[model samples]
Target: AQSVAQPEDQVNVAEGNPLTVKCTYSVSGNPYLFWYVQYPNRGLQFLLKYITGDNLVKGSYGFEAEFNKSQTSFHLKKPSALVSDSALYFCAVRDNVGSARQLTFGSGTQLTVLP
Candidate 1:
């Protein structure tokens, strides 16, 4: 079975500073990793994905993540943080070998960007 681990329950960052939300995953076969963000009352929105590409993958809102194969980690990073970036972030993973497209999501990390 595959699973995602988000070590932090919340991440606090100052506006204009860099921000990161950690994520590590485990799976039996090759992993397809993804990141998503959720607003106060909105559904989870896809941020980016790592299907098969360069180690560094860029996504929406200036967010980017590095796919570390050895570490099995995909940590989201942003050069600068903004107040509007405060939201819940999730890391999801699924085994590419399986026919099922089910994704196992992390516990979710609430990012708080202070002005």
Candidate 2:
């Protein structure tokens, strides 16, 4: 089984300040992690992924995530946040060796960047 957790239900940040959205996972064998963002009335947009190789993965809209094997975490980060960056963020995980082809997603974290 694969599961993901976004501990924070909501995250608030001031414009131009650094922002982070935390994610942690548990899975059998190796894990494939991903981040997605959803705006108002919009579908999920692919932000980034950690399939293999690098521990640090970069994604769209200046977002990046660090894959920490020891912590089983993939925390999303941005050096500076924008008001437009406010949206719902989701963390997902999939078992690399499993027949289950679906990715398990977290409940989602609402990010509000105040100007």
Candidate 3:
């Protein structure tokens, strides 16, 4: 079985400050990790992924994530946050050596960028 966890239910950051949304995962095999963001009344938008290669992956809206295999963690980061960045963030994982193609997602973390 594969699972993801976002320990923090809410993350508050002031505008123009750096922000982070933490995520950890457990899986049977090598994990394919992903990050997605959802705005109010909108579907989840793909943020970044960690499949292989570099430990750091960059994505849309000036976001990036670092994959630490030793720690089984993939934490999302942004150098500077915007009020518009406020959204529900999800961390997901898929087992690389499984028949299950579906991704198991975290409970979700609501990020609020205060102005």
Candidate 4:
């Protein structure tokens, strides 16, 4: 079975400091990975994704992720945190399974940024 786990329930970060939200995934075949962020009472916004390119992929809002094949992980990172960046984050994966079209989300990580 393919799955994703976000180990942290919440991450508190100070503004202007580095931030990281951890994610680990398991898949039977090649994995199409994505990172989406959701603000309170809003839809999920696409932050970044790793399809079939470089391990180091960059996307919206100065965010980036690295795909680790051996570790089976793709962790989201930012050089500096902002108060506006505080939101709920989710890591999702889709594989070659028949029932895997929709994203299976993690429990979610609530990110809090202090000014």
lDDT of 3 at 13: 99
Return the candidate ranking by TM-score, descending.
3, 2, 1, 4
Please report, in order, the local distance difference test score of every candidate based on alpha carbons: 0.97, 0.96, 0.96, 0.91
Using Cα atoms with residue i matched to residue i, what is each candidate's TM-score against the true structure?
0.98, 0.98, 0.98, 0.94
Model 1 bad stretches (over 4 Å):
none
**In candidate 4, what are the lDDT values of residues 1-115, reduced to their tens digit?**
6789999999999999999999999888888889999999999999998999699989999999989999989999999999999999999988766665877677789999999
Local accuracy of candidate 2 as per-residue lDDT tens digits, 12-86: 999999999999999998999999999999999999999999899999999999999999999999999999999
Q: How many residue pairs clash (N, CA or C atoms closer than 3 angstroms) in each of the candidate models, in the order given? A: 0, 0, 0, 0
- The stretch of ten residues in a row with the least summed lDDT in candidate 2 is 94-103
Candidate 2, residue 25: CA error in Å? 0.1
lDDT of 3 by residue, 47-101 (tens): 9999999999999989999999999999999999999999999999999886889
